[model samples]
Target: MKHTISALVKNRPGVLAESSTAFHNNSINITSISCGETENMEVSRMVICAEGSDEDIAKVTKDLQAMDFVIKLDDLARKEFVDRELVLIKVDVNKDSMSQIMQIFEVFRADVVGMGQKTITVELSGDQERVEGLIKILHPFGIKSMCRTGMIALKRGDE
Candidate 1:
């Protein structure tokens, strides 16, 4: 099963490394992770996605919550939340293919952020499904390079 764990930690150096090391030592496979400062500048929130059995997830959660820097922890996988990811992809292009690629980009609502002699770079942000859909559709165009920001999520409703 996949699990999303959110942790609030003090805004200090090495916190991210420590947290990741804990997960590594526990044998958790992190598929995605993102962190940024919270409303309180003194603290930061980390959203992490990992795959493991329920028992394994529970153990890691417990261990993470016990860390000195972790002020709070939430198992977002079990809650209703909104998640998103951002990706930038560069695809090979030519006069003949440029128009076709632009049409496809319009269909996906992706923006052409850069253009080079033989390639066009696109930037897209949305849920995992939407991003994956665009990538699948553009595969035939030949992807030169791509980069993705891992999933970031927040709970729904008033918390």
Candidate 2:
């Protein structure tokens, strides 16, 4: 199983490191991590993923919340949130296919971020399914390189 955990912790040195070390000690492998500040200097949102059964994740969550620097924690299951991923892809291109490639990008609302003699880099941000779909479409055109900012998610309703 995979769990998406949102942690609000004190924005101080060693807080993030200690929290991550706790997860590590529990044998949880972090699949993704992203964090940013909020209005409160002592609080920041941290998103993380790891493979663990719900029970195991809950235990980890409890441990995390008990940490001195942690302020709040939420486990977002499939029901309560929207998640998205961003990816940059560099695809092989030629003059003959340039227009066609542009059309494809237009259809997906992907931006052409950079270009070289043999490649064009596209930047795309969307739901996971949509991003994966775009990648599948671009594969036939020869993807030279790609980078992904793994899934970021937030609660859906007013909270």
Clashes of each: 0, 0
TM-score per candidate, in order? 0.94, 0.86
Best by lDDT: 1
- The lowest-lDDT stretch of 10 consecutive residues in candidate 2 is 71-80
Off by over 4 Å in 2: none
lDDT of 1 by residue, 86-146 (tens): 9999999999998999998999899999999999999999999999999998899899999
Q: What is candidate 2's TM-score against the reference?
A: 0.86
lDDT against the true structure, each candidate: 0.91, 0.87
Off-target runs (Cα >4 Å) in candidate 1 are: none
The numbered model that scores best in TM-score is 1
